[model samples]
Target chain A: MGVFTIAKTITGNLFSRPPTSRYPAEPAKRFDLTRGHLAFEPENCRVCRVCMLRCPTQAIVVDREKRTWECDHFRCITCGNCVELCPTDALHLEPAYRSPEADRPGKEFHEIPAPPPKAEAGGETAEA
Target chain B: MAYMKRSPWIIHYDGSSCNGCDIEVLACLTPLYDVERFGIINTGNPKHADIFVVTGSVNEQNREVIRNIYEQMPQPKVVAALGICACSGGVFRECYNVMGGMDKVIPVDVYVPGCPVRPEQIIDGVVKALGVLEEKRARMKAGAPAEVPA
Candidate 1:
C-alpha cells in the first residue's frame, strides 16, 4: 500500500507544472498595494514640503521657492511615508520598481511649474 | 558576451543588517522564486563564486569582513547590492557606526533599492549583474582594466 502511494505521488510530481515563475521571461506578479517605488507628480504638487519633513530617510527634498521636488532612489526605503503625508496627493507609490542600475543615477528632480496668477474681479485682463 | 561557458555561482554576506533583506535573499532560492533556472547557484566559499550578493549597511566592525569577502572573489566578478540598506545605508545612515552603502567598502555593480528587497527585485539585480560581468570579462580579455575608477 505504501509503495503504491509513493509511486502515485512521484507520478503527480513528474507531470505537474513547476511552482517557479519565469520572472525574466515574464513580468513578476504585482499587487495593487505593492510598494515598489516612489512617484511624484509635479503638476498636483503645492510644494508644501510636507513629504520632505516626514520622510524617514530624508530622501525627499522639496524646494518651495523654486517649485522643485527631488527624491534619491538609492536612499529611498519605499516605506510610503511621503506618499501618505502628501497633502496634495502629488506623491504615490508605484507598483513597478525602479530597475537596477550600473551606477548611481542621482536624485530624480521634478520642477513644478508655477501656477498662473488668478484674475481679479471687474479688472482688465492682461492678454499674452 | 559569448565567453560565459559556466553557470555563475554567488555568495551572500550579511553586514550589520536587520535580517529583513537576508530573508528575502533566501526566498529567491525557494521554489516560488527558484533562481536555479537561470543557472545561478548559491555557493558557500567566495573563491568558488562569480557574483557577490550583499545585504545590509556597512558599519565600523563589519567593514573589514565585507572587504575580505570582496577581495576573495575571483576576477570578472560582480557585486549586487540587494536592498536600500546595501545601496545607501537606508534608515541607518544616521547611525554613528554605519558607514553607508556597500560602495564605501567595495565596488557595487548593481543597486536594487527596496526597504527589504522583494525576491523579484533580487532576481532583476542578479540579471543586471550578469550583464556587468560580461562586460568585465570582455575588458579582462582585451587586457584592459576590469573595473573603472569610482
Candidate 2:
C-alpha cells in the first residue's frame, strides 16, 4: 500500500494535464495563424453566386431574386475560400474553432442578417 | 511495445482536396497541435495503420484508389473522414467527379467536421475510434466475435 500509493501520487503530479488541450473552459486555444469562421457581408455580395458555386457542401445558399442570403451554420465547412474570393472585402475569416454542438444533424445554424443600408460615412451628419 | 499498441497508428489519405483541409490536418501533427502524444502516428502504409484518415471527398478518379487502399488495410480497421469535404462532400457538393462524402463508399467510423477540420476536432474523432477499438478488443477477448478487425 505504501509503495503503490506513493508511485501513483508521484506519477499524477508528474503529468496531470494534456499539454496541447486547453478546452471546454478557455476555448480551444487558437494559434496566431489559425483561420476561424468567415464573416459574410451580404450587402457587399454582388449576387454573382460565386461563393455558392465554390462551397464544398453548398452550405451558403443565395436567393438573388429574394435578395436573401443565409449560411447554414451546421453545414459551413469554414474553408475560407469565400473569404479569399470576395472582391468587396465583405467576407473575412475569424477563428472560432469550437463548434458548441457538433453532432446534431437536423438543426440549422444561421448567420446574422445583413444590416439595412446606411448613409455614406463621409456624407452622414450628426442627428438633430 | 505496450504503449505502441495502445496508441494505434493512423494514415492520412487525400483523394482530391483544395488543400485547405489538408493543411489543417497536418497542423495536428505539428508542435503547436502535438497529436503525437496521443499515439496517432502518420504512417506511410495501410498495413501498418489502424486508422485510415480520408481527408477529401472521393472523386471518380480517386475512388478506385481509395477502395483499393481500403482493401489492402488489415482487419479490424476504422475509416475516418476528417473534413466536410470527406464527411458530406462539402464545397464539391455539385462537382461531377465527386460522388459524395467518403461514406458513399466506405463505412466511416468517425466523421470530423470543419471546413478542413480543426486539430482538436480531428482528435475528437480519433478518440471516438479508440472507443470502438476498445469495444472490439473486448469482444474478441471474450470470444464473442470471431471476425472482429484487429
Tell how far residue A116 is off in model 2, in angstroms: 18
Model 1 DockQ class: medium
Across A3-94, the per-residue lDDT of candidate 1 in tens digits comes to: 99999999999999878887767898999999889888887776667788888898988786677889999899889988777766888998
Q: Report the C-alpha lDDT of model 2 over B1-150, residue by residue, as the tens digit.
A: 232358878888896877877787788888667778766788989889888888888888888889988878876777877777777777676888888878777777676767767777777777777666666677777877624332
Per-prediction TM-score, chain B alone: 0.94, 0.87
| Top candidate when judged by TM-score against the true structure | 1
On the 0 to 100 scale, the lDDT of residue B78 in model 2 is 75
Among these predictions, the greatest DockQ belongs to 1
In terms of lDDT, the poorest run of 10 residues in model 2 chain A is A119-128
The residue-by-residue lDDT of candidate 1 on B24-143, one tens digit each, is 889899999988877889999999999999999999999999999999889989999988889999899999999999999999989988888889888888888988888899999999
DockQ of each: 0.67, 0.18
Q: Rate the local accuracy (lDDT) of all candidates.
A: 0.85, 0.68
| TM-score of every candidate relative to the true structure | 0.91, 0.61
Q: Give every candidate's TM-score on chain A.
A: 0.85, 0.58
Residue runs of model 1 more than 4 Å from their true location after superposition: A118-128, B1-6
